[model samples]
Target: MVVDDSPFSRTLLADSLQQEGCEVVGEADSIECLIETYRQCKPDIVTMDIAMPGADGFECSRALLAHDPKAKIILVSSMKDEETEAEARRCGVVGYLQKPVEGEVLKKVIEGVMSPDVLYNNLQSWSIDIFKEALGQSITRMTKTTATFVEAECSEKNISQGITVVIGIIGHYPGSMILDISKESAEKMAEVILRRPAKGQDEVVAMGAEFANVVGGIACSMLNKKDKAFSLRVSPPSVFYGAQTEIASPGIRLHCLYADSDFGRIYLGVGFKKGSVLWM
Candidate 1:
């Protein structure tokens, strides 16, 4: 279930959820209709937007919990503050995702809340340490600057007006690897890689793709080395730019790795289809 005043946001979020193998049973733009929508849809989870007509997300969340004590609600809002998060928790919200939520992050949060034990075991099995090491090494090798692992979060978000490089993974565990960075960050990284200032958007985008390719290649190699049966092939990187670009893959469970450098924050993501042998 998705609730938002903006039709565009609703559609975008719904599409992302659907791509994550979630069935969007219902949508509501106002709190007045939220109860009815929830009752009719009988959704297991709800993504509630903060701002809306009549009542805000906090109140609606409380109402939903009142209606159904088992309701699992995650508050989505553009505002990020301690007070908001505390209040959301007070209202019985299970989770909170700041807008614009990234699809990978959102899916993880949902799964974590739904089945914490399973999510925790899956994360452990995924060998997050290997991916983190690969990311750190790749960034240092490409940029000649040490990259530090900051923090990683999962959410459904809109990457507004940025450069995104996507590389598809094909083999025993087919999936995709994506790198999303701001234009300014791309330009800075491109300059570092080229040993000169990036001239235009084309150069920046190309450099971004190169960065993603190197990182993806390294990660895949490391995974395959750890498990001989996990042979993986990476497709050529694809780049895209737009005002508000969202990416998601249906039936895939996504994980994001965050690294910080002189340029800016880098979001490295790996996604594999649910029920893959890799997870089992």
Candidate 2:
């Protein structure tokens, strides 16, 4: 929501937010209209103009905040002085933006005011995207056939396969990816890639490790590019073999996904634990 007396400023702010893919839920010209509009729309962020007709931005902010203590409000004005900014801070304003604020600047301030859980959820989404796309594209590049997620086990997320490769993710978000593909399937994929018969279980194990390495490296590279804070690095692949093998990761967010291709189904168990000492 935007509360500004000037139609041009309101339109500009709304347009900038819309370009950022945010919906403009409500707009108010002054404090008189802000409360009703807020109650009706219940927007996530309210950008309040400091200079208005009657009450000014400070009183308006206080009024709205009194109504909703949890309201995330941003004060915008031509006043860039420290005193004005301090006053805004004292008024419970979560963010302050000077007039002629750039669209990206406004977006960053809005993101800054967002709750930690919301921000973490966004990071989780981006991380999951990197993992899913890396696995699918890597397999497709290797086998020349499209791979996609199929029906996957939700309970236990177990791997009832002959071989499992563990890849460690280190740095900001430490995690592990357990990749499992049966020995026969691994051999078939090796045959497809090498255009020859796979040597045996030895070669299959090596190939499986290499496959996990490639996928893990891709995920880490993408994350490192996403944000330097992620500071992610892929650890050397570890290989294990058994029937009904599973690994436990305490204090981590976990998700299991399975993808299928002409070769076979790939069972992936991915988990990440936060609170690592950031590398940079």
Candidate 3:
């Protein structure tokens, strides 16, 4: 299956796949149509585009995975930034190919996606310890204070009465990492970073997003160093401020780490895809 907003790109991709001796099962120009088309075609693999009219490929991938946890979806996009690719993985996409992808590369990616060893290798690339180290380093660099890791726990409750900044992780391993801190803590951190009193809610939220970005970037670097095979990328930080902000996705595992600092308590939440087991 091929899903893209552009008819030309869709046709081009389909033709390439066909030339590679793969059957082009179905094509969709939008996310809504793709879901229905997927049901009808039941394709073994789907090549998706990032941009669309209504819902983008990220949202569509999430919907598809919710419907079928084992869906093998690969994103093909011209916007090949680390942020975009990371978000795609968080949406449960199996693979990613940048724009102007070669026919041989696409064929190889499709074949690799079907292999059990490749899937397990991708899953094993994620490390909670690396995540913790990255977060600690980021906090120290930004705030001049070392964050002490207290404990990590699996939780079903939504974050309430605080600001949450989320960064999606992509590439071989797909997941999400969230930095959850109270408004007061956020303001304090913002004040330290800005060298001024943080007054408004917007300022605090922005600081929270920056915190997530810094941590995510460092984490990706550490992960790549450990195993280049992961090809990890991180999405831009997404900020949310309110009481009871739910960050739940069905079939995804959520692991929350509590770290204490002089400023306040910081919660680092890591959400992994269904098949990837969380190693504490």
Most accurate candidate by lDDT: 2
- Candidate 3 wrong stretches, greater than 4 Å: 1-126, 274-280
Estimate the overall C-alpha local distance difference test score of candidate 2.
Answer: 0.79
After superposition, the stretches of candidate 1 with alpha carbons farther than 4 Å from their true spots are: 1-124, 274-280
For candidate 2, write residues 1-280 as lDDT tens digits: 9999999999999999999878899999988889999999999999988889899999999999999998888887787686876687678877767788777667755754664445345557777668878899889888888887854544544546778888988854578887889888899999988889887878878988998899988987887676544557889998888556765545665677888878888887676775412221
Show how many residue pairs clash in every candidate, following the order shown.
12, 0, 0
TM-score of each: 0.52, 0.56, 0.57
Better of 1 and 3 by TM-score: 3
- Scored against the true structure, residue 172 in model 2 reaches a CA lDDT of 43
Where is the poorest 10-residue window by lDDT in model 1? 271-280
RMSD in order of candidates: 15.6, 10.8, 9.9
lDDT of 3 at 59: 86
Per-model lDDT = 0.76, 0.79, 0.77
Lowest-scoring 10 consecutive residues by lDDT in candidate 3?
271-280
Clashing pairs in 2: none
Mind giving the per-residue lDDT tens digits that candidate 3 earns over 216-266? Answer: 888878877764545568988778878568755456676667889878998
RMSD over all Cα atoms, model 1: 15.6
